[model samples]
Target: MILKCVAIDDEPLALELLSKFISQTAFLKLEGRFSNAIEALSFLNQNEVQLIFMDIQMPDLSGMELARILDGKKNNDKTRIIFCTAYNQFAIEGYKVEALDYLLKPYSYEDFLAAATKAYQYFDRIHNTPVAKSAEPTATQEFIFLKVEYQLVKVMLKDITHVEAYKDYVKVHLKSKANPLLSLTSMKNMEELLPSEKFMRVHRSFIVALDHIDSVAKNVIQIGDHQIAVGENYKEQFLEFLSKWMS
Candidate 1:
């Protein structure tokens, strides 16, 4: 999902940095850049924007005042703000206006990406769009992106054999690869992201793709060369599914 956004900062260099950061992010699109809040307010009146990266301190109109004005506009609730400034003192004030996030000046690209990802998640929930995307999906070609190291690796849903929990991450075992894809995300998150109709959590540490199961033996599930044990807490549900499968 691409979020239409603008940058508002009095300093030319700051606006440049925000513009550069937005360009680097995959999900963000730069709609406009303003050196002051007044011009930005005027432009905002004519255009619809999903987000704003604004400076707190400015001449004539301040970012906080603009946020309040935006809060009053009709059908403007979709637009969110992330304040960028040098002073950390106004952090509370920024949130009081209900800004989505606050970025202190000299923030790195990593920090900016984190805030943008948060915004993406918010939009994704309300819009019912997946944060991860591949090529146009058919009935059977659905896919998702996993953060592997510094890259977002796309994995087709049909290729996922099973998911295993690492200490702080999840290992996505795929049919097309010899090794599992390691991502720095929790198992709980993986469970939520995958469609419930296609993937089932059979253990506290394992989520197996329903179509990939080779056979079920007692409390164990066999998928290719791997044998996964069903936890006691999940055994009943697994059995229920097994009954339905056999019937």
Candidate 2:
């Protein structure tokens, strides 16, 4: 399916480059391009854009500001957003807006592809499902909210990198954090919480997020900067996941 897309940026070259990229891309269908948020807002009011390539800074309005306005509106399920910016300061704001991905300035086609592919997959996950789950899904379903020392935390199956079995307690590693925040839990209890589609108990010591993986080589799996070892018994399942997804 073609993604109905829009680009909102004041810079002419930025707009040109995005349009140029979208023209070459097979899946993205550009519905509109606006120089500023005013024009983009008007377009958004009337049209249904499934994917947005947005800039954070502009003359009269900012992308973050625009996203805030969009956040208040009701929209269809398949819509996705990717923030385009040179500044790293806006990353937190982008996350607050629930952007699918953030693109640093002068992004290459490969970077664009990575972001776009994620958006497409997200759209598929949302629309292809028989029943749509809430963005902030229920607490009672499967995930646990655990207290580590004094702080209580909510752990989602999708964000988990791995759960390390250490004697009686297991360490939970989740996504979107600068460092992994470990909580006291058990492998047996946590395993039951994970969605079968997104996670795999690859080893007795490790359970991995299948989508967050960066690469797999021989006997190890790379999730972003960290490397997790694949046990002897789990090598086959690990290899199959890598083989199916890796180009």
Candidate 3:
């Protein structure tokens, strides 16, 4: 599948490099290039692209800010983001916006190709033909794939105990693993993808599996050893959920 893509970066060299990479990739078609997020936003308003390769730091509007805006839009799901930055600290923040992948600056062609391949696979899976789509999981889909360290890993929904948002990534707490599976994705993305009947976002940074919640006290949810506090914004809904089973 040929993915229509755009590039946004404040640095002229970065934009040039990204453009070169897109040109070399057979499956990617460069639709636009912007030196600022403001212009990029204007372009996005009028056009639709499957993927975006954007730099994090920019004048007036940063990539992170732009990502949040895009994520909140009506057609937000139509576009996927791949963040390119020089700073490693923003990795966790990138996932918060549900970025498809993170590309550190001075990356090689191979690195760019790997990320593009992921975008292609993602678009193909979601926009498959009728027969193919029919064969895929329905609303009761039991699992999802997450990009971890540049590779996609299949995670069983039932195995997840909770998901905690880190700085730029999310830690998928699982019952079977001693340590959480760290993936480059946002909690919002996880929340939307998960079955609402089974998962609930108790905090801005936390999503807990309903079945895995052992107890709730003082507006805090206990799952295994984790004590997750329900955010003020989410407390009302969570209490309503609890009322259904309370004596």
Candidate 4:
């Protein structure tokens, strides 16, 4: 069945781009396009939109703000989201909002297809489950808040690439930011705190953001310019992950 989809962004060109993409894919049916989040919200209340392609920046209401407004409701509508943004700074928060994936501005048709594929799989997974969602544990998995503890730290939840283990300490690689921050903690503990579906512990020293992965070489996984090794034990699971996108 074709999935009902909608696009929301203030830029006319951006909406045009999404429209073109929807036309290319037979399974995606464009239901509506909104220039702002408020209009999109009102339309959602009355329409059956199964997927949303949203922009992070808009007049009055931003996409991040819009995600907050949609959270924790029993829509049971199985609507998936794919955020379209220009800035890499929003990548982390994009995950926080549990976006299926994001399309960076200037992205190619292949890129949009990739993110859409992920979104489709996500919606399918949730629909087949007919399951209940357990509440998240509080006081667990707190983020590395930025700029509060003096100048010594400033990496927010939305700026991290991965956390590497160094004995009892773990090193966090910041997104598009110079230098990684060192934290005294076990990688195992961190894996528990982070949403397992989003962050994968492919190595004792590496817990990477699945969406940030650029390429996976024989022994290394590339997140932009950084090259991370694939531990022997975790190699199978990593390969299995790549299999999902093989098509």
Query: How high is each candidate's TM-score?
Result: 0.59, 0.57, 0.54, 0.54
Best by TM-score: 1
Candidate ranking (TM-score, best to worst): 1, 2, 3, 4
lDDT of 4 by residue, 100-207 (tens): 778889876656655664555455545555345456432222233221122224344456788888775677887876877765555765575455666788886799
Clashing pairs in 3: 91-168, 92-167, 92-168, 92-169, 93-168
For candidate 3, write residues 1-247 as lDDT tens digits: 5789999999999999999989877678999999999999999999999999999999999999999999999877789999999998999999999999999998877567667766765776566535446676543455666668855577788999999999978999999999999977667667766768889998999999999999989998999999999999999899999999695
Comparison by TM-score, 1 against 2, better one: 1
User: Candidate 1, overall lDDT?
Assistant: 0.86
- Tens digits of per-residue lDDT for model 2, 1-247: 6789999888999999988777666677999999999899888888888999989999788888888888878763456679999999989989898898999998876567557756755665555555555565433232444435444455565667766777755677777566566655556545655556678888888888788778777678788777888888978877787777766
lDDT of 4 at 95: 80
Mark the 10 consecutive residues where model 4 has the least summed lDDT.
142-151
Question: What's the C-alpha lDDT at position 58 in model 3?
Answer: 95
Clashes in model 2: which pairs? Answer: none
**TM-score between model 4 and native:** 0.54
lDDT of 1 by residue, 23-65 (tens): 8777789999999999999999999999999999999999999
User: In model 1, which runs have C-alpha deviations exceeding 4 angstroms?
Assistant: 129-247
Q: Rate the local accuracy (lDDT) of all candidates.
A: 0.86, 0.75, 0.86, 0.73
Worst 10 residues of 2 by lDDT: 138-147
